[model samples]
Target: MTKLDITKTNRAIENLLETTENPRHRFMLQAYYRHRYLEIAGRYEEIFAPEMMVENPVYHFHALGLNVRLEGQDAIKNLYREWSETGECVMYADDEEVAVSDHMIASKLTGYQFKPGKVLAAVGIDVDDENAMYIYKASEEMVWPYDDRCRLVGEDVWEVDPDKAEIIKLDPADVITASDARTMLEPLIKPLPPYDEAAMRPRATAR
Candidate 1:
């Protein structure tokens, strides 16, 4: 991995934060910055490694002051992967991410965590207060992909003729196949090299 100009990088991000974010989001962004820098320090081989990515990760529930059980990361990670691919993100109450896995892995993510504005929004998606929802879904849906459901259709429009419209239902198994999964994960798992100043200077996306 290429080494970053640490002092320069810190000053740059601090300036970015000062100008763009609110106080509440600052802490979240700083934490993301540190974690992102750590991954950068490690050159990201471990961060994206399947054997290491979720290996005993501490899944913290911000609202509950709790964490996932030892083996829980397996289910949680799977839920995360599926959610990243298909869940509709909503800013619920104060929560920002509520991933609706086909199996409903968790519920009531009251104050979810998404990536920050920088470093891929800190690129991690986590949920809080999630256990109750995992218990609500029938077990078979988790195992067999036996149930297929349609997403909300024609949400913003005022009126639609029901007779002419049809919603296409997708099967997660068919959609998240090997090729699709790679396509979805490629960007997230890309290497985190030091920023190339000219190439990465915040521009249109920031505004």
Candidate 2:
């Protein structure tokens, strides 16, 4: 994956959100902002690996402040206990309106594709690209799973339940809408900052 200039992207997004008028345009801007957020959060496997819980105790997706706390043995015990009582894992969707299916939850546990629309709704937007057709088709890959209880397994592998994953496939019309939105609002989007020479300087070695 190519490295992204996050600071620049954030600035540009802020600018776009500030000046955009058309609803579609605003949506596309929000999409890019959401994309940047995920990129900084790291890949799904790295963030949700079970082993990470031992050291960090909690994996916090900073961009959105959504986190999963790992309580070691206590967590497993509680999960089993809850399952015994309720006959299901104790999981909740970010949006009450968006139901969490078994497949969705399992997918999250197994490091499968996670959709962002539900979480974005928490920040005040309702988006679903289920047809995999959006104007800015380039961003589809940036989306990742947002698990409430991600258990990491090994260095690069995770033990996610395929049942818990949510898929957001966008149709061709959706893509056109997204693109039209961006075009209408591009002028309002924020421009990136100029380069800083001092910050780019190499460190001096000790004599």
Candidate 2, residues 79-99, lDDT tens digits: the string is 334332321211112111111
**Deviation of model 1 at 39, angstroms:** 15
Identify the runs in model 1 with alpha carbons over 4 angstroms from their true place. Answer: 1-54, 62-73, 85-190, 194-207
lDDT of 1 by residue, 1-207 (tens): 121122232343345456644332333234333433333232333333332233434333211122333234465446344434332111111121221222122222122222112212122313232221111111111111101111111011111122332122222232222233334334433333333334332333332
| Top candidate when judged by TM-score against the true structure | 1
Candidate 1 at 161: error in angstroms?
42
- Candidate 1 residue-wise lDDT at 162: 23
Estimate the overall C-alpha local distance difference test score of candidate 2.
Answer: 0.30
Candidates in order have lDDT scores of: 0.27, 0.30
Per-model TM-score on C-alpha atoms: 0.23, 0.21
What TM-score does prediction 2 earn?
Answer: 0.21
